[model samples]
Target: MCWQFPLLGIVVDFGHYFVHRAMHSKFWYEHIHYVHHSLNDGGPLTAYYSHPLDFLLGITAPVVLGWWTIHGDLKAFLVYVFLAQVGALYIHSGQSWLGNKWHYQHHAKLKRVYGLFGISDFCLK
Candidate 1:
């Protein structure tokens, strides 16, 4: 019995959108995100290059908020978590992009890619 499906959807989407935006900020980039830059050629493993703090920010922020909002139910929490993980894997994947090399370009150029779902960046270009 899903008590709050619509609200949960809103929360999840908004959380992802805002959290992704936050990842592009200078503060995040300077400290934690820089580790991922070591990957001059991004691929599946590029996700692992992220600093632990950035990982916490990317994964835990929504989780903490979700925990605060939801009752103690493992089922809903697990589902939300699964979806988030799948999304993360896909976004980090080098498979889908206008150019398969765009991510590598960012790394090679030592610039940031602000698009969480793509290899595009206003600042990094």
Candidate 2:
């Protein structure tokens, strides 16, 4: 699990970056991701405000793929997923836990700062 952790992280990073970026595109935004952005001043539960398909593609699929890719331990994978969801909740809650600025800025300018850890957005910038 230790060995697979970084690999899963990398896979999730790429998957999230691409899926999130795509969700912001005009068609997707209007139909799906915009539902998420509707709560401009987000709450703890804002992370789950998205369309069902948006949630599946933008959140669940990446983690599932990463787990599958690594043949991850079920317990460890569940823990990782729980933590990630909590992090996203914190981010959207505007609690200043970490990464709040990035996501808030994303709300400010919908097309920028699409990645979780900021690496992909930084490179794109």
Q: Which candidate is the best by lDDT?
A: 2
> For residues 1-125, could you state the per-residue lDDT of candidate 1 as single tens digits?
26644445455455545665676678976777778776655466676668887767665765667556755267766776677567555545776654545455556774444444342243235
Q: Which candidate has the highest TM-score of all?
A: 2
Error of 1 at 123 (Å): 20
lDDT of 2 by residue, 1-125 (tens): 67666677777878889999899889999998999898888888988998999999988999999899889999879888888888888888877755377788788777477777776666666
**RMSD, one per candidate, in order:** 5.5, 1.6
Over 4 Å off in model 2, which ranges?
97-99, 123-125
Clashing pairs in 1: none
